[model samples]
Target: MNAQSPKTVDDTRLDSVIYQDGIMRISYTLTKTSKDEIDSDAFTKDKKALAASVSCDEKGLGQFVKSGLLIKYTINDSSSAPITDFQIGKSDCL
Candidate 1:
C-alpha cells in the first residue's frame, strides 16, 4: 500500500501511510519548509482541496472514502517533530 511512499508532494515529503483504528494517517515531512514557516490558516484551507480530490477521484482514495474512514494528514518538521495534524472524513467529502 505504501509502495510509493517517501514521495515528495509540493514542498513536503510524504513519509509514510498507516491504517488503524478506522483512520488512515498519511505522514509528511517538510523538506525545504519548516513548522515556523507555515501559515496555519492558509495551510488549513488546503484541506478543501484535499477533500475535493478524494471525493472526485475514482482511482485513488475512492475506495477508502467509501469505507467511511477518517483520513488524516500529519506534518512533521525537518527535525522529525510533529508540526500539525488535519483530519478529513466522509462528511468532509459531502
Candidate 2:
C-alpha cells in the first residue's frame, strides 16, 4: 500500500453524502490491506475524515454521537462545491 497522500485528492475518489438529519455518510474502497488491520477501525477513521470535511458546530456534531453515528473520515472539499461539514456515526442501514 502506498501510504503517501495523493497530490490531488479526488472527491470522486472519496464520495460522501449528508442526509437531512445531518449525518454524513462516507464510503471508500481500500486499495491495499494488511493482515493486522481491523475492518472496524478503518471504517471508523474514514468516517471521521468524512465528518471533518464538513463545517458544523460541536453541538450539532454531538447529535450524531447521541444518535449513535460517529464521524470517521473527513476530507475537506470532497466535492466541486463546498458542502456543509457532516458527522458520521453508527447507522442502522449499515
RMSD of each: 2.5, 11.3
* Each prediction's number of clashing residue pairs: 0, 22
For candidate 1, the 10 contiguous residues with the lowest summed lDDT are 47-56
Question: What lDDT, from 0 to 1, does candidate 2 have?
Answer: 0.42
1-94: candidate 2 lDDT, tens digit per residue: 1243233343234444434454445434332333234354565566556554442345555545555655444333323322233344444223
Q: Which candidate should be chosen as best, given TM-score against the real structure?
A: 1
The sequence of per-residue lDDT tens digits that candidate 1 reaches over residues 2-92 is 8878998687798999999888888888887677887767876785576557643668776677668788888788887777787776766
| Least accurate 10 contiguous residues by lDDT in model 2 | 75-84
Clashing pairs in 1: none
TM-score of each predicted structure versus truth: 0.75, 0.27
